[model samples]
Target: MEDINLTIQKGEFAAIVGPSGCGKSTILRMIAGLETPDTGEVLAEQEIIQRPSPDRMMIFQEHALYPWLTVEENVGFGLELKSVSKSERKTRVESVLKKVGLDGFQSYYPSQLSGGMRQLGLAV
Candidate 1:
């Protein structure tokens, strides 16, 4: 990797548009702590990026929604892994599903959603 410099402050929305295999996803993965750099660093809150944390999240071009999980299940997947409580998880999953326009489809599986819907599901 070259010495590429990038930064995004809180509440910022930045897009790294690029052709296929041009490292856009690589950069994102690195920033998400999914990939490590050989000769550089990734910092979050002034600390070096180490591994996946709730404070940082990533949604790839290919939706990572689990096939067997219902829409609600997938949206709350992360919080579930973190052992969030039932009511809190339900509230969060519902809120995000509504935010992504999947409010009525929470019981559906990824296989039932269109590509865009799946992408939205992954995003939330």
Candidate 2:
């Protein structure tokens, strides 16, 4: 992974593909601020990423939603952590759920939803 210079434009999706242990996850971890490069820097939007940020998230292929929380709770968890007002959080969560076609499933738990629905819940 030495001298790896990559630029991912905003709104542009990129994928890193390679054999196992070839540092693909390491690169993603660096970008997510979960790991630090010993010799180089990882930047997002021109800012050096030194810690985990709400603006940046790593949603693994597996289900990452909290099993104990309902869909609405899982979707609003980040906003809750940021101290967003309850009303605002509700509004935003409802908006996102509506957009994702999960508006009526807010009370459902992760295990209750289908695989695709669970993934969408995680994405929200």
User: What TM-score do all the candidates reach, one by one?
Assistant: 0.67, 0.71
Please list all clashing residue pairs in model 2, or write none if there are none.
none
Poorest 10 consecutive residues by lDDT, candidate 2: 52-61
Tens digits of per-residue lDDT for model 2 on 12-86? 989999999999999988988898999979999889999989788776779989999999999999999999999
Kindly give the number of clashing pairs for every candidate: 0, 0
For each candidate in the order shown, give its overall lDDT on alpha carbons: 0.88, 0.91
- On TM-score, the leading prediction is 2
Q: For residues 1-124, what per-residue lDDT tens digits would candidate 1 score against the true structure?
A: 4878998998898989888888888888988899998888999989999898867778767778889999999888889999999899999999888876889998999999999999888777
**Alpha-carbon deviation at 37 in model 2, angstroms:** 1.6
